[model samples]
Target: MNGLKAGLAELEALIAAPVLGGCNLLVCPPATLAAAFAARAAGTHVQVGGQDCHWQPSGAHTGDIAAEMFADLGASHIIVGHSERRTDHGETDAIVKAKAEAVARAGLTPILCIGETLAEREAGEALVLIERQLAGSVPEGLAALVIAYEPVWAIGTGLTPTVAQVAEVHAAIRAVVGPGVKILYGGSVKPSNAAELLAVPHVDGALVGGASLKAADFLGIAAGAA
Candidate 1:
């Protein structure tokens, strides 16, 4: 919540500066902060998004936020199948696919995340793992979805896969997702490595972690995406 507020304030300042024109920004904050951020971002170039959403549009699921609620709050996008959600909540591919469908039904774009762990990569199973995740996690007619590849072992670990490795995984993911899907790289994406990572084949953008908390780093990564 605090970070969202801080980012909104920073965005206002950046917009006021005439030199910072021609940039697009999207902020995905916690559910509690979505409405507030959406209202604050109204009429601004900055767009608001939800960090996660429930698989069902409306249900008795305890402590789960639905995608419709996020859309009602004016969220334009929703992050699904994040590494944290998969690791901490034990979410599977089927669950993520349902969530993606819910997001689409709610009229929001779903950012579908897919990746492999260190063990899988070490065993030469990264492509295999990603293929399964892509096939099982994404629904048919995926034009409204965005795919983010976040290697589980790299997130918050201060470690990242090599440029060649990233390119290979992204290429494999793109092949499976077809030509329309935008494949983004995530996991410890820092300003220092953003340039190289963004240059990789099939890498459309990044789902940054700790580095995204700062305006400078996030903007640097965004700029690299261009």
Candidate 2:
């Protein structure tokens, strides 16, 4: 939902000036800019992605973009079941699972997102809620995928959970999903706390949002991953 044509050049220059750390860098820009950004980031370690995709390969779905469409645009990954999608579009877990399967079928890694709201956390049902989402949204026997835990309340609010709290939830996700799946912590991730958050156990990386819109801030967060 962000980033303009001009912005892409600035970001590409920054990334090209110096290599990023070992962590994989991916950006899911608006669908309109997918191919352009993909071309812009080509020949670099950076990868381009899609914000979301339709479960179907192609149909008369009107405005909906298919998973294969994103794949054709040189996107290496696509995000599914983002909290905002669930909240705004009323997408159910079943829908997310179908979309993830589609993304995988399209030969792109699906970044499955799962998290709880503030009310659910306060009610002491955070773990229970996330566990249910994991079981429902994640497909069986899918060995390759990325999971991002973005608490609904924390996203874009400059709010973040404590390291222990983040570790606790991530550990829970790892417990249910088994090993091999990288779990990234989202929600207001910035340079200031990126290192500390990335250090948390089971916290494989970050699913940055707002901070990633800027080159310096995004690079700073990526530095923390190093």
In order, what is each prediction's RMSD in angstroms?
Answer: 2.1, 1.0
Among all candidates shown, the one with the greatest lDDT:
2
lDDT of 2 by residue, 1-226 (tens): 7777877875575557566657888888888888998887887888899999999999999999999998887889999999999999999999999999999999999999999999999999999999999999999988679999999999988778888889899999999987899999999999999999999999999999999888788888988998
The alpha-carbon deviation from the true structure for residue 12 of candidate 1, after best TM-score superposition, in angstroms, is 3.6
Residue 91 C-alpha lDDT in model 2: 99
TM-score for all predictions?
Answer: 0.92, 0.97
Model 1 steric clash pairs:
none
Q: Give the alpha-carbon lDDT of every model.
A: 0.84, 0.91
Mind giving the per-residue lDDT tens digits that candidate 1 earns over 98-134?
A: 9999999999999999888889989999898999998
Model 1 poorest 10 in a row by lDDT: 14-23
Q: What residue runs in model 2 are displaced by over 4 Å at the alpha carbon? A: none
Q: Scored by Cα lDDT, where does model 2 land?
A: 0.91
> By TM-score, how accurate is candidate 2?
0.97
Compute the lDDT of residue 168 as modeled in candidate 2.
91
Q: What is the lDDT, from 0 to 100, of the residue 14 in candidate 2?
A: 52
